[model samples]
Target chain A: MSDLTAPGFPGEAVRLRARTGAAAAFPPAAEYGQVLFGAQCGTPGDQLDAMRLVPPVFMPQRLAKLIDLGREPLYQDVELGTVIGGFSSPLPVYVSALGSTRAAGGDLGLALSRQAGALGIPMVIGENVVPVNGYGRLDEDAGRSLLGRLRAYTEHLGDGPDGGVAVQQSTEDADAEVWNLVYSDPAARPLLDSGRLAFELKVGQGAKPGLGGMTVVDAEAAARMAGQYGLDPVFGEGRVLRSSSPGTFTAEILRQQIRLMRNNFPKARVWVKLIPGRDVAEAVRVAVEAGADAVTVDGAEGGTGWAPSAFTGQVGLPLAECLRRIGEKPPCLLVSGRIWEGGRAVKSLALGATAVGLGRAALLAVAEDQQDGLIRFVECLSMEMRLIVSALGKYAPGEISPDDVWSP
Target chain B: MIEDGPTQPGDPRAHLSSPATRSTLRIQNQLLAAAREYLTSAGFTEMLPPVIGPVTDPGGRGSKQVDIDFYGHRYKLMTSAILYKQASLLAFDKIFCIAPNVRLEPLETANTSRHLAEFHQLDVEVAGASREQIIQLVEDLVVHMVQRTIAALPEEFAALGRDVDAFADLVQGMFARTTHAEAVADLHAVGHDQSADAEIDWAGEALLSSKSSRPFFVTDYPKGSRGFYDRESRTEAGVLRNFDLIAPEGFGELCSGSERTNDYAEIITRMRETGENPQKYRWYLELVKEGIPASAGFGIGVERLTRYVAGLDAVWQANAFPKLPGVVSP
Candidate 1:
């Protein structure tokens, strides 16, 4: 540890830590987790933004399309439908893991779920929701609970075989047996029967690469969760900081965990979410080899409920670097960071991402208009994807290749 | 009905004269005769089932329905006669149908060793029967069918390499009864990962069936696992009064039956809950509203039973002309 008062040292973070004490380690996400993220604090070296989708002058796929259609082709001729991590999705995008943070847990969470369900895209409910909000309580307000989000998602889910839901479990959530509860809950029967449910193993998130989930809990809830979590009185009387341990895992542990998931929830799809670690490519290979249906890579630019701002900006590999590191055609490679627009999404797809995850952008969209904000946001992104793909002389999202993206 | 027309290339009739198929047909005929004998002796009236209807059972577990244009309206090929079995109870206390069904099961199921695109079912219904009554009825019917087939064609069993002792436990009343939750627990204990709230998945079902020496009834399936016609328990909020009769030695589910719901309000609510449009089920709902009797019934797949009894490798071996999920055959 270097001296904090060195004349040439970067002094802003240290000075802030001095003023706020232990509280400075985590971002002020309770006040601005859903809204202000990605606008100001983002990975400064995002290579996805550096790449451009360059269209060809000779459009043979479009010519083939013309012959197939017996006329000229348009951007609308592009089809976005794809299978994401074993779930049929109308678009090559999904609602990423939004957990039981204060800003995302209640009505807004339900609203986001409904929109995502109606859109016929898979939605991942993030970690620690069960431990924090109670699995579900009918006697009390259950709207913020994990079951509440599932019910909300299934309510507007369409008749087509498009959408599904994946429930994530952290170490604390594993203690609650979140997967077993959802696997047996009557509320999840529709998805289970239809083969649309999945269980996501939370290895780590992008925002905090090596740490567990962090949330600001009220004193009463803090006292209740004190046994399961590391509860620190960093925020004084009314508010406390709750920290969960990032569960230990080796390659073999990951392999067996996926095997256990497959054996325990045979009806449900198996998903493994990996952080933007230095060895992300190896982790992805290990997960895919162990029979994971989908392996999600959350880049350093990914958002979280609570994490240190330093980690958010500088802790892990950017999504583009992760994709480059993983190389070509890893099955069901789901990458997420600051994926808000079609340009970055198309670049990700070209760089070998099977699909892009909408995280903070989804939260912001839902917060903007709880009714149809996500729907509109997706509409714009999808339209842009179609236009870009069609211009590249391709008619499907999966047809995008590295040849189409120009790094310069 | 044998056809006299010119045989097309790759016709299934080419193999009809084979020894294996001949033995299979012999066992099938005996099973059919035994089913008719057993049901009629129990005071069940035999009725020809309608092959096309405005609405059919919507709980085929990921299977698609076949549709045809009937006059100006769209009609669906029967997946199961479960709905009409309830209506048939209006004229008779007990009824049975040698019914034909068509289901477009997922292409992946073609390798499951138990699925067929076209098949027949021995559909049976009894008025004023409880879930337990139906379970007992299915058990007895299965025992009788197996015993009759063995007695009628002992040499066929030997020729097909089917051991008569394989079904001894069934004939000796060794059929076990387990709840859906228990079955799921059993699968989980073996690392099968079966969902407790849904039907046992295909692999899990096979695992349980293989472990049993005798046929067993898995009862009290959760509400959403089956169609709305399966009655919900008044005592339990989400448990349905239903059961599936699984065959031994990994033959998988042989029969599925449940106590039928005749209350119009409950039927409508359940229909909506299961994602079925009530308007499409208008005729059935109207009949249900007119006070149909409380009944319990089940449909046992004839091909599946024949396959199990003959110890065949696949259900298609039991049929003269097989139609696998994605395969086109005569």
Candidate 2:
């Protein structure tokens, strides 16, 4: 009868009594890493011997959905609409995390965020943005700061507030209390109020597991950073090794970190990014138990701003393998590494992923045509996704299951 | 080992050479000499450590290894001489060395009082020895050093305000032995969070160390938390048959040792599981493939031991030429 829904309304039970008269109706509301989870799509998708999607002739779930539809169902009836890490999305894809790439800095970052928001899917703003670019409230240097991305996302966000922006915090960022700063800032109030902000605690990346971030800097920069990082004049006398400390997370530390996030900022969602280490499944369990809204695992194929060449090729587990290792799904499992298309996306979803992240693919799409490039790319993906679901004799993205594909 | 002294720019001479650091330095020297005397008496031969090698230990806490140009080939500075310790087993069943190590530890470690950019370890390897035997050797060696120091120089302890009585209980008797599970539980009981499946973190380790009244062994660290050589336990699936010796009164980890794996197949599996490229360990892996002796050993941080013994403020004080991580010093 009234606006009151939840029981024991904190501010006033008197107003609830006035509306209900002890028998009134109450309306309720509900809310819901591949390579950075792209597998190595090396061969040009034209393998005559490549594996194909295999759907059973007796589609029990599809038949059930068809019965629910009160008629024979087609591919178009598939409810592609799903909630990803608390954000509503038109499709099951979200822009994967990206750091301060040249394209991720000023105008390009803004454009990408705007487009991601318009697409109604969530986006993760990756590490080092706060440390390299500034936090939004201060000088931020011509809108290349962390808050700049949020502003871009919020400005272009359409009427329904379907997308959220998750900002990742590395060890350096955590040392700077990036989450605390952003959570408490008035500038971020809009995103907070709209429930469109999340914080991703970065444990490790796929490109380099068990190692910190490594980058080369010129002699001048090295001299300045020599006191802050472990520097070496490895590339001759002119260049130095500038390394970042990886965030330490044993199972307990991870649990406590996620708990701390929930306690400190009740309004924002908590996410964790893990390198597909040998114990990916264990780490995922710990994260989910600690009340994380989502957990992202990046396979060894994930890219980074600065990583050793050896690490990229040799270090983490492949995304597909990581997913297979995890086996069963937690409540929300997001993957990335090299994920860019429909078949792989469908395979990942069928393999128990809640959603898939678009990393380098999103960037390249935007880079090729900043205005409509991403739009066209995502549209084609949506179409392919529909086709795959219909071919599987299922109508929803989430319905694509382990039964839909055959693996060796 | 260098004892803590005043640090000023352009001061070439060690502050340890000064009169104020004399007593601490004496204790430091005694600790080393006592270790040498004990190990040699125990029939351990000493080896000179290599400064550079093809690869170094993949320091798990994200400590970076220093790579140098070794005649146009990429060579890493010795982060730990554990690999060399294993190789030396080919020559001597019992080997010891006051080996130097360089670890580009994270900047945060600079504040922890236990870390040093350049330091030494009293490395001892015993071929054909069990984990218990090596742990017993450590106990005996540590006791002998302390008793020798306490008897030889009581005034040094007084001058440095270190209580000679700290070694009274440790003079004779095996130290406390706690499993990694027990230590984690103790930490949790103290209102601290510790990982059940990873290495006891730096903070957790310090917390446990500070709470102890005597030096203790925390054994059975998780398999993935360490370098590949630490042999996995047959009885325990997830744990390595390794141990870390934690100093009393919050000085933190003094040393780490483990039962080394000898099987080629097992080592390769461990290597891949740890994300280590087996190729990087060409020489060491060759030794494993060809068959090296099954042994157990530990390396005690020379400076860390000196700090705990002399009651110095930080590990840098134990160095004659210190490299306080991130600080440029000669």
Candidate 3:
């Protein structure tokens, strides 16, 4: 390195020094490692295997037109900020649907692990599994199977040089019984340790704050979930399911899960993701107090795979307020919703967030083209990030601060 | 003077005289044309967004709610044009819109001097530019609009005994840039510490006594006090890339604007912490996904602007059918 007192490059040196300071402030890279698994809805075995070689592969749903091919091609031109996976927030049954088909050349877990290892992107599997219906009852078997599969899948994937898998969990039933299985599963330990596997305790999503999620529990799936909950399968098709049980008691169950994860996998990061709402601060306080390592906030503008018209269009909070409240907490803040570019990411970081996830933007890349599309998306976001930092007279992601923002 | 009297109900033209109304309509038309020309010359295109939104986002402060039935679904009416700001960030690089907005204020008084339930706002936004460029554009547009309007109102100016040239000069002079800190310091220099935690009776009394020119920009607001999207000055303290065009009249603030937040992660965190879900805004986020060029924009309150120009004390006087407290009929 050049002399620290160099005239022409002192600014550069100072910037480099500041970047080093920021890196020091950041938790160890492995501590923040997130393993995102792309459980492509009905992805083919051959295509899934192909993803294993890529650094980090984001799998979009297998289109109806391509499902019969037994080889789904990844979008090749999408960028980093593009949204992947389902447009609407995924439901538990949705994951169940993928899981049921995973046996038939759709092993979402193996694909996620392989693609994560290949692309060098952390693995986070969006498992929209719920264990309850609109009527109070637990879908034990479905919950157990989903959790078991996730645990097994992460373990099978093992930890790369970086870390393990991060499971994005959306539970329908918040009872202790349901969480007990999720927390106590034997396979979850190793994945949680080595910082490979983690848990995302989802409360309300940005697309539908305070609105319960619905699962089109098919006859067979309904029977499985109902049997686990000890309920007679008397209800017909399209049974609506609420995620949280009676009162705020469900929060306790999440707390227990956090404790269990920490105790079992001391290095694993636990995050609680909630939609922006009137009561977000209180909710975040609960999550933090509940022993969460970080909190992920989703704004009303967040994309969902499918949601009620009212919930998607009329409910929840916007991103700005979410950042303001979450800023109060310095923990690892992973935010999602409609994040598209580097400037947006920089803005969030400045306002006090560790990182942001590209759900819709990621999906859009895959939907528009394939893996190339996804790569293009990431490139576009990275370029934007660099440009924004340069314009703000800063270098690197760490130097960007909230002081750089203002209202016109 | 005509006595205030009750008129027959449900009659559209019952209270109007054709000759007077015709002249008023003609003048309003002329004013609208002048304003439109000024904005168009400034390179702003007219655009519109869905008036009914899912929730009130961060930029929406002091906004009103309207109930509208959309294809069997009922939705609230928009209180301001801020919603269009985000939409404009997506579809158009630079755009403006003149539209009606509704708000529900429970504190209903019969004064009709400073309040209105429904009004029009001349909402303008520009992207892909810097803060300095936007300020210059706004100044030019305001000057153009005022010049044209005054030129067309020779009879009114003469009747009011107002010096048209002096008025024009005053408007032009106020455009000279000044910082908020400087303004506050000037106020303090006059022997009043307006910074006191308690209300400064002397400061308020002095300001009320002053006959300052109407229409000027208040630049460089405190960073912590500004909205989430504003860009803070790179080289100043307590100053954001923000400006408020205030009119010396009942219409206190005519326009409020600032540069937007361009950092992806910061934007996300702000949205989430504020209880806003980014999932609903996939398209909006895409604009910034690759990064956004430096830009700034502002919304000019149409009713307030018109009220200032027309010398109307109440906002209701500027609207065709003003909605005020407890007044159901137009």
Candidate 4:
């Protein structure tokens, strides 16, 4: 059949031709996979836990694997229905998470990307990519360097036909597509096509929201990312100021990231993760408006390796309430918290989440056994899902809708 | 008593202007002084912790509605003096504090005099001690406060025409020792049918229903039934090293005391099992790790005690700014 008149074709005459041909062949629901990949990394195992809580002075190849997990084939699988990639640490290591000052030094983004690639998982990255004066300070030069490193990694993954990286700039500074474009260049297109590139606009993290991120601004690294993203150069150990709290910087940053992603790779889906709070609905609305393909609502119950007790316990809304409110929107929603049992994940989906992310549980699995442990954890969750489904007389994960939920 | 005027129902201005029959301000001040002195003599340093905590770290029980700005930050009022108790353990070996605790009560009934929206507690904590020490301290303090009250209000007691002999006999009788088994046997001896398979609540009811005189201590509780922090008794019965100071009339339990757990590893394990983060309480764990001496502590319901002493029916009568049901302060 001609490409134009072929079944499932996008162009004109495709509808007319369908009337003369038999129904297109499609696989049974049970035959298809529902998992997707974003990046790769080591399973949170005993080995990692046993590693002294010290900073990584010298970057390890394993760190690179983590970053790769956040790249193409890994993230592509996450977008498609195969095996869902667990998004681990992609941001700079904080003192709390690492437990030492040395591990705080290395290229955190690169390390995370490589890890994601190794694990064949798509990881979320870049919350406060910009530098702030007091918090996560980054100069124009540092920003440029960091963007350059990201661009180099994306290019290495191979983006377009020429095998040369493609660079698409956003129309406006606040456009979300700006970061997406940078990640979807010709050099990175290969990874994007493979669903390894899962672009995200991080509105709020599990840590303090009003406060920006903190990263040791290496001039060389900052220049790389800055140059790649078309920002001015940064210099020295001086900190960079990104945005201030009670400000519109978060919304602006999200818009820019979305605009960039759409301009570069329209096929790839984008996500925005936010902490649940009293104004969660409003935040979700903002994310949706910024052109997020999906939204993740991280509840106060969600665990982080390190965060102030006050922020960890008091800052965010509960996952159930957040999901219930955000589910009003049509976008795919992912919820995180004490989602251990299958009932919990199913309950989350039933409450309006398209999926649920497990941080501590996943870490526990990895810490206990490594990759095998993580796989086992997932299996346990899947089995739990199956049992719950059978009990409810439902089949697919999508079948576990809000209709199955009941508030206590 | 029967003045006739236009019946302005529920009008504040039209109500009887007669003076309060029970002027308790002076008595209340004197009682507070006496309680503080007694606590101090027991080696408790006075302290005060922040009234506001992160909305999320509500020590225990249900979630609280915290006041926040447009950004959704939450600041909850202190629910209890437990935080201060925990903090004071770090500095003073023995400490005590009197503070107001607030909580929203949906089921407020006329008979619910014990459960108030807000109440006061004379919270105390002691480290480096034993269950016996806690019992002695609580018993002595209770007696001392009662004695002080009697001495200060001879005229009032005389006016009420209450027999001092009855009060003295009641005080002396409570100082006597009685085990849980003995208490149970006493109840049965008095024709209160208590089965061996009965729950603690059933036993508690049997004891409360008995025509026991004055105040007494209910000791040797089952370890599994009490909070995880309570120390288990070393005796054969495996009971918890805890006791409740029960009073006669309307006052049920005026004080709860126990020897706290000092084992760091066990405390962490228990906390983890309960799904509470041990990291958040790192400071508290440090104390146990440093090998703090085994101590016993107890908290007295200041409001309950005052209410009993003043012959007041409700706890609100003891509190200066009482938060009553259906009443919102400006």
Quantify all predictions' global Cα lDDT against the true fold: 0.82, 0.75, 0.49, 0.47
Q: A137-222 in candidate 3: lDDT tens per residue?
A: 24444223455445434444423344334555443332222232333344444543345445555565676676544434455655
TM-score of each: 0.54, 0.58, 0.41, 0.40
lDDT of 2 by residue, B1-330 (tens): 124544332254647465536786788899888998998888989899999998887655535567577886668888888888898999999999988888766554566777787889999999988889889888888989988888898888887777777766678657899999898898899888775766677778878877777788999986656767899889978678889998887788999999998899887766655444455677888888999999999999988888888877777766777787666888
Model 3 over residues B137-229: C-alpha lDDT tens digits? Answer: 777676676678778876754543334564555456346555566656666778665432111222332352243464667677654334446
lDDT for model 3, please. 0.49
lDDT of 4 at B66: 31
Arranged by lDDT with the best first, the candidates are 1, 2, 3, 4
Q: How closely does chain A match the true chain A in each prediction, as TM-score? A: 0.88, 0.84, 0.57, 0.52
- Which stretches of model 3 miss by more than 4 angstroms? A1-408, B1-27, B48-50, B53-64, B67-76, B83-93, B106-112, B156-168, B176-211, B223-227, B234-239, B272-282, B290-293
- Tell me model 1's lDDT, rounded to 2 decimals: 0.82
Model 1 earns a TM-score of 0.54
**For residues A267-312, could you state the per-residue lDDT of candidate 1 as single tens digits?**
7898989999999999999999878999999988887377877887
The clash count for each model shown is: 1, 27, 131, 130
lDDT of 2: 0.75
Candidate 3: deviation at residue A123, Å? Answer: 46
Which should have the higher TM-score, number 2 or number 3? 2
Model 2 chain B worst lDDT run, 10 consecutive residues: B1-10
DockQ of 1: 0.02
